[model samples]
Target: MGSRRRTPYGPGNPGASLTVHPLEGCRGIRAAGEVGLATHTIWEGVLEQAVREGEDVYYLELSEVTFVDVAGAGALAAAAGRLGAGRRLVVRRPPPALRRTLEAFWPGLPAIEVTM
Candidate 1:
């Protein structure tokens, strides 16, 4: 098992940090941010990395995310569609806004997993 680093979230963190940890052939994407237009660059890079590595299951840990926008949701959909064959995208936790967006756009795409 890996240890979780103590990183503060919000304006103080500026979402400057993201850890891509691979476990049991699965990728863990831990992000701390609002994940909006301003931080889309980093989010984009993260998505690219997840795709490039062809993670079997992209476990996006967004429990720390306080907010997310439509662009970000779109990115998730695009990334999920572009993932390697048989690989799926799993979003462990999403803000209400993002969740609603997912329910609207990807209502039946089981590839995008939403957790309570």
Candidate 2:
């Protein structure tokens, strides 16, 4: 498994950061840190990688993520939308607001499954 890290500068928010690590024994990733305006690009890159993997079930283990903004959740939904039929993205332990944003804006999306 490989590891990547991105720390984007945010005005008055030096802690804005994101790290993506490939999941062992699976075609997926485990991400940590905050996903907001500053870290969106890295977040999207991680999602893009997941899509490129073309696995039937892509897992996003985000239990360690401190926060995820609405746009970040939107990006996740958009990435899941790109998957082929019968393919899905499993989102594990996301932030509460991020989960709500996904549920509110993209209810019943077939390609995304949220789990605690």
Q: Which structure among the candidates has the greatest TM-score?
A: 2
Model 2: residues >4 Å from true position, as ranges? 1-13
Location of the lowest summed lDDT over 10 successive residues in candidate 1: 1-10
Per-residue lDDT over 50-87 for candidate 2, one digit per residue giving the tens place of the 0 to 100 score:
78888899999999888888888889999998999999
What's the number of clashes in each of the models?
Answer: 0, 0
Write the residue-wise lDDT of candidate 1 on 1-116 in tens digits. 22133334433345434333443445666666566655666677777777887657778888777777788889988888887668887787777888999989878775677886
Question: Which ten contiguous residues of candidate 2 have the minimum total lDDT?
Answer: 3-12
- Cα RMSD, model 1: 5.0
Shift in Å, residue 99, candidate 1: 1.0
